[model samples]
Target: MASINQLTFIKPKQFEWHEVPAPTLQNDGEAIVKPLAVTRCDLDLYMASGMYPMQGPFAFGHEIAGEVVEVGDGVKGFAPGDRVIVPFQINCGACDNCRRGFTNACTSVEPFAAYGFAPTGERKWGGGLSDLVNVPFADAMLVKIPDAVSITGAAAISDNAGDGYRTVAEPLKQRPGADILIVAGLAQSVGLFSVQAARALGAGRIVYRDYDAGRLAKAKALGAEVIETQYSPDLRATEEFPIVVEAAGLPDALTFAIRSTQPCGICSGVSAGMSNQAKVPLRSMYMKGITYTIGRVHARTEIDHLLDCAHCGTINPDDVITRSVPFSQAADAMMDPDIKIVFERD
Candidate 1:
């Protein structure tokens, strides 16, 4: 077995370099991949903050874009050296949920076990942050990376970008051309994607509110109308946007989003905030007839549409990636707030 290097979060505020055996074909349908690029999810912060119910000494991270290094004998439709993006959520395409277009919720794997969490397959294969990873049900889980997309750019799309697209675009099918309000955090990737996704959905107007000036600047550069923190106290007075997206991972932001949305409007809560309980104004939401949708993303349903938008130049998600760091520095890069960081091996 070949030795591989990996980053492990042994405890909160602690990370150590460890030498582990490289992953090999564990099943006839599995594939081994060398990550071309990887990234940290906002939920990682929750785990580090001791807010999430995650066990320690586990591999962390989910978003990955990589080159296929090896494929098991049973695998078809993919070959070695193919570049692909591994979505954080794994699924078997043959399952009923997957056939119904819910790949993220596939029944073959343990509930919510992807990269950065516990092992779901035969081996304890971790996320893309490692030198090599084993992807179970490879034929169903991998998507070929487009030639036009850079590895760093494609990395973001695997998770947050896809998430932002699903949160707004999927809901918009039921409510088209509705105004959008995104209450996001400046420190995370979701805010940046929210800015781009809203525009691609033909939103009548997009309003973004964040505490970070740097993020607000980026949002403005992306053509989103910026609402600074000073205006947050009176977010309800600005305008009644029918669609609201809560990506900040903060409970307060969710509350604000619920209050700002109009009656019969939809508020998509995409944050994985550690808090189990949220204080919502039930009376207000009930009286105003507001609707709320929350939980993990459904990216497979929207990836094709998002790719079409990207191919036609209707959306440019690459703009949200502010920095690309080498895989060695990913740990430090994630701690920095100045830029949205993407990790590349080469």
Candidate 2:
């Protein structure tokens, strides 16, 4: 039996690195991966603290830039000793959804086939923080990390960073040459990702509103004008925007995004923790003709464009990673107060 150390939950809000069965090739198309760099999600905090749902034998994490160690006979486009980024979502490329380029909603895998945080399919696949992970559809899901981009930096693209690119790319199609407004927060680092994505997508202008002074400074460093909305919840710029990205998954943040959007504008929210039941201004949204899009992302679909941005130094998610710890220290790294943590070896 192939077993290795992986992070698993012993109790709610607690984790430890324990040796478990390393991921095996369950199918002919499967591949085994060893994470060179992995990260914790903002949602992981909620799951760890029992704020969200939980079940037995909880596995943690999904963001990773990993090295391929083994490939099955059917695997294509990858082999042993190749560096790659494993998307947080599990997808089979030949499925109907994937054939149409919507890999996030692929049907070959069970619906909501994703890794980590007490979600379903725990027994079927391993999490990103594990010493080894089994990838079911290697050709479809695995994206090569560009030569110029460091593995640590590429780790973020497995989820947060790639979603950031999609967050703006979806809206830009509707309103070309328009500006974008991002209501960002610490949830999942999507906030900072929005700032980075908007700039790379060639928005006419970008404005980031966040309560965190430090995050605001980081936004400025990313070439976005900043609005410090800490003490003032009702505050907003007088001018509205054509594309508004609500990356902050906080209560009333959606309301604010809807209110601040220009009439007939597009507002896309990246936060998954949003309440299905809440005080949403539906009437206002209808009256303004706002188009609101929210849900999980197809990280692999948007990875190529992000790869270009990273290779040329257009954006640096590594700078946003405030903490770097060894893989043995990953469980402890989750307790960090920093914006982001990347687990790597010395």
Best by TM-score: 2
Tens digit of per-residue lDDT, candidate 1, span 1-346? 6788887877766666688887777679999888888866666665665656576686767788899989999999689999988877777889899899887788887777678776655546586778888888888888887777767766777777888887788667788887788887733668778778878878878888888788889989988888775323344545677888887777667778888888899888886466677677789899999888887776555566677777677777678877778888866665555446777885
Residue-level lDDT for 270 in candidate 1: 83
User: How much lDDT does each candidate structure score?
Assistant: 0.76, 0.79
The residue pairs found clashing in candidate 2 are: 13-48
Which stretches in model 1 have alpha-carbon errors above 4 Å? 49-53, 119-123, 230-237
Cα shift from native, residue 53, model 2 (Å): 3.6
- What is the per-residue lDDT of model 2 for residues 59-149, given as tens digits with 9 covering 90 to 100? 6778888999999999879999999999888888787788777878888767777877555543556678787888889988898888888
User: Alpha-carbon error at 114 in model 1, in Å?
Assistant: 0.5
How many clashes does the backbone of model 1 have? 0
TM-score of each: 0.93, 0.93
